[model samples]
Target: MQLITWNTQWCRGLDGVVSAQRIVDGARAMADFDVLCLQEIAQGFDNMPGAPGDQPAELAALLPGFQVFFGAAVDEFDAQGKRQRFGNLIATRLPVARLQHHPLPWPSDPSVFSMPRMCTVVTVRDPVLGPVRIMTTHLEYYSQTQRLAQVHALRELNAEACAQAAAPPKAETEPSPFQPKLHTPHAIVCGDFNLTVSRPEALVSAPEYQAIHRAHAHGRLQDAWPLAHGDTPHAPTFRLFDRTYGPDPVTADFVFVSDSLAPRVQRVEVDLQSRASDHQPVLIAL
Candidate 1:
């Protein structure tokens, strides 16, 4: 299976053009991806910079056969009753078995600006990997307090799934609404983590590292970069073409895989050339 994860910046490129078509075409050029995970998709709020509303709908229309799921981290309605949503998306060619929207922690942090964040999780039947969960999310950018809380929430989510997978509750009736769906320890979590790291290539386990953003999953999760590239430093995914965030380039995007899925990581790469969005697309093949 080949998967691509990108923070499309609401489909806005560094050149100041917001085009979902361009984002899709660019990702296609990078890899023949089976699963596409994206963060920071916007809908129905046309006021934001270059945001063409209903991006999830636009993206879904772009990929016909793929099953698409959009989880809105922020859902609001204006006085005119028009709804607006912003969050993560997952589209996969594989058979989608289950879909979930998990809202991450949004603790009060008066010191800095922040927003609600979420993880969009979809379970797909990979012919070789069997049942696999693909989780994609974007963390709070400005506040470390909120980011750390969100990180633990994600880990808790993984722990919950692991527990459910180990022992599913028995269902007394057939075709019941309460029937437990397929849950697996095999998972790939990816997106714009919005947290930077120094020497990510140096550390192998037990931490997100910098008070770190990526939760090490307590031995359950492993960064895919080191698994593929060893000690080579991570290629910067943010502020590469546009350095408004910092003077030098930094990596705020990543892909983390459960230990069970680590060996299946045949290849992991970043498309350092594309300017479709501020973030470079990260691809993993199994």
Candidate 2:
């Protein structure tokens, strides 16, 4: 399976371009990405300039064959008295089995007022891979404190969801010995984590990686990047070669996996060349 994660910056390209067609075209050119995780998708949010009336719908229209799920981190009334959304989105070509919305903790910064961050979970049945879970999220970018808390919340949420699914169904009826039992499904955590694995406090296996590690330890989620590229020069997923930003930047987009699904991790690539969005899309294959 091929998966891509990008922060679309409300589908507004660098300089004054705001075209969903261009974004979709760029994504299609990369590869037939089975799942696409998009962050910063604006939908009638406060009547901002270049804001689409309905971004998710527009993207769905652009990719006719795909099923889409949008999780609104913030929903407020627009000037026209209609509800508007600002949040994360996932588009997939496979049959959707489940969809969930998980809200992340908001920051306390007084000056950095913005919409809340959230994670959208999409479960689909891949033709060759059976059942798979795709979780896409954009975390708090400003405050490290808030981001750390959000990470912990995410780990606990995932564990709870997975555990509930694994539990046997409650029923008074007798079970059939010939019936097949399903195992706990695998999950793909892809998004702009904002917290990099290079940071000791963000790693799942490290002592100071924070409570998120503890939560995932029970859930069995593992970092897929280090597993695939282990200390390689995959730095700089952002600020693409523009001399104005800085000499070097850091990577914030990530693709993580459940410990049970690590064996199926085929490859992970940080596509630094794509200018579909301000942030580069991280592609992962299984």
Candidate 3:
């Protein structure tokens, strides 16, 4: 399976134009990806400069014959009482078996600006691996406290999934909601983790990020970059062209695979040339 995960920044490019078509074109230019995971999609928020106001619909229209799953991390109303949503999206051509929208922890962080975050998981039937979970998310960017809590929540969710996979529920005789869903230890979790800085070693060198590695490691989620590339440095994924957010580029986005899928991880790459968004896209082939 091959997948690409990117933070589209509401499909806004460095040129200050929001075009879902451009985003789709950029990804297609990079590779023939079977699945696409995106973050920071906006809907019904025209106040954002150049926003189309319904990006999910626009993107779905762009990708025909592909199942698109969108989960709103921030859902609220504007001054005019129009509904607004900002969240992540997962698009795949594979046969989907189950999908779940999980809201991450949102603790009180009065000192910093933060927003509700979420992870959207889709279980697609991979011909080789059977039921495989593709989880995508975007964590809190501004608040470290909230981001840490969100990371813990993600680890817990992974643990639950692993547990369910290990112990299948009592099978139902009839087909219904209670019917046990497809369970497998195979999973790929990828997104813009918002875990980078001016330092090139920021991906794994930081103490907080180290803890994150350990947490996910305990849950069977290992960074696919090292598993595939081995000691090679990760290519920067954020602030490459704009540099408005930071003086230098760093890799905030990542792809983590469960231990069961790590051996199948064939390649991990970053498209450095695409300026479709402020953040670059990361690709993983398994």
Candidate 4:
């Protein structure tokens, strides 16, 4: 299976053009990805830069034969009284058994501006791997306090999934909403984590990132990059040669796979030439 993750920046390119078709074109040029994960998709928000249209719907329409799931972290009424949303998206050609939207921690931090973040979890039935969880999220970019809390929340969610996988609830004879949904501990968590920084002294090097890596060592999750590339330095996925955001390039996107699927990792790569969005797309093949 091939999966691609990118932060579309509301489908705005470096040329300041917002085209959902362009986003789809860029991903297709990268690979025939079975799963596509996107962040910063806007819907019914015309005030944004470059006039992003109904991106969530547009993208879904553009990708035929794929199951599209949108998790809106920010939902509010626009000036025209229409509901507008901004968040992440997951589209897959595989069969999805279950779906859930998890709102990340967003405690108030008056000192810095922030917004609610979310993780979209989808359990897809892979022909080779069977039921596998695929989670994509965009973390809080402005506030470290909130980002740390969100990271912990993600860890807790992973633990919960693992626990459930170990002992799933008994299925009743009657079909109801109370019935447990199909899920798997084997997962692939990917997206723009917003953990890298341009400045050397920034709070991007916080211990929370290390804690996540430690979980991998404890046989829970592992970075797919290392599993595929060994100790090679990660390719820059954001702000690379794009002075509009920052002078220094850094990697803010990643793909983390459960230890159970780590060995299935065949290749991990970043598209260095595409300018479909401010960030590059990270592709992983299993």
Candidate 5:
């Protein structure tokens, strides 16, 4: 299985334009990804240029045979009386057995900072592996405080999702549209975390991120790339448009695998040249 995660910046490319087809083509050029996890997907918010449009469905329509799941982190009406939305998205070729949207802790920071963040978890039946969970999220970029809290929330959600499925051994439980069977609780969590693992001074090196690491210390959650490449530097996942490269293209995006599925993590690919969005896509194979 091949999974790709990217923050499409509302599907806007370097040309300073939002093109749905460009986003689709850029993604397809990166890899024949089985599952694509995206962040900063806009669904026609009035404040944005083309406000109140169903861009998710629009993108999905372009992809012929993929199951699309939208997690609306920011759902509200703009001043123009149009519905505006912002959130993460998961596109998969496999059959989805269940889907859930998790809203993160948003802060009331006055600074032009913390926007709403969210995560989407989907349970799907892979052709090779019977069942698996794929989660995609974008964390708070401006405020470290909110981002840290959101990290904790993410850990809790992971535990809750697994526990819900691992509750009983009954042949069949309450049939629900949002829950799935849990044979082994395999999962892949990916997206633009906005917290760089490369900088020790970064928020990811703080106690909150450490808490997330501790939760995974049991080996339940592991970063996929370092698992495959031990000594690799932060691999520069973001770049300012080709006009000029700054101090560094921050490494904020990630692809994480649960402990049970880490061993099968075959290869990790970080396409630095993928300019479909402000951030590049991180791909993982199993």
Candidate 6:
């Protein structure tokens, strides 16, 4: 199975043009993927950069034969009284058995600007892997306090899933909303994590990276980059060579999987040439 994760910056390109069709075209040019995870999609907000757009509807209309699921972290009524939403999306060609939306920690941090964050989780039936849980999210970029809290929340959520998989709930009667759904320990968490290690002097440092590795060592989760390219530095997924957004490039996006699925990681790559968004697309093949 091939999966792609990208932060579409609301489908705006370096040339200051916002086109949802171009975003789809660029992703398809990168790889023939079974699953597509996107972040920073806007809806019914005319004030955003280029123009007002319903990105979710536009993308769904553009991609035929794909199940589109959107989880909005920011949902409110605009001045025109239309529903405005901004968040992550997961579109897949595979069969989805279950779906859940998790709102991440958004405690008030007046020290810096921030926004509400969320994760979109989907349980899909892969042709080879059977039941697989895939989640995508974008963390708070401006506030480290909020970002760390959100990270802890993600870890807790994973632990909860693992616990549930080990001891599932009893089956309920048919036609009930409380019916037990498929839950798996195997999962893939991918998106613009807003994590950076380049400037240990200012922002995050080695401890953050160590925490993630420790989780992997305990047989909970593992980073896909090392599994594909051992000991190599991660490729830049944000900023990179795009000066339109700034010259200081850093790696913020990632694809992480459960340790059990590490061996199935065939390839992981970043599309360096695409300019459909400020961030580059990361693809992983299993």
The candidate that achieves the highest TM-score relative to the unseen native structure: 3
Q: What would the per-residue lDDT of candidate 4 be over residues 93-185, giving only the tens digit for each residue? A: 999999999999999999988989999999999999888899999998888888888877777788789888878888776789867688687
- Residue-level lDDT tens digits of model 1 in 87-189: 9999999999999999999999999988889999999999999999999999988887788788888877887787778777786466777776787888888
Using TM-score, rank the candidates from best to worst: 3, 4, 6, 1, 5, 2
Q: Write down the worst ten-residue block by lDDT for model 1.
A: 204-213
Q: Local distance difference test, per candidate?
A: 0.85, 0.75, 0.87, 0.86, 0.76, 0.85
TM-score of candidate 1 on Cα atoms, chains taken together: 0.93
Q: Count the backbone clashes (under 3 Å) in each candidate.
A: 0, 0, 0, 0, 4, 0
lDDT (C-alpha) at residue 81 in model 1: 95
**Over all chains combined, what TM-score does candidate 5 have?**
0.87
Rank ordering of all candidates by lDDT, starting from the highest: 3, 4, 6, 1, 5, 2
Instruction: Please identify which of the two predictions, 1 or 4, would achieve the higher lDDT against the true structure.
Output: 4
- What TM-score does candidate 4 reach? 0.94
Q: Which residue pairs in model 1 clash with each other?
A: none
The alpha-carbon RMSD values of the candidates against the true structure, listed in the order shown, are: 2.4, 4.4, 1.5, 2.3, 3.1, 2.3
lDDT of 5: 0.76
Per-model TM-score, in order, reads 0.93, 0.85, 0.96, 0.94, 0.87, 0.93
Preferred candidate (TM-score higher): 1 or 3: 3
* Model 6 per-residue lDDT tens digits across residues 12-70: 99888999999899889878889999999999887889984899999999889999999
Task: Name every residue pair that clashes in candidate 5.
Answer: 44-52, 44-53, 45-51, 45-52
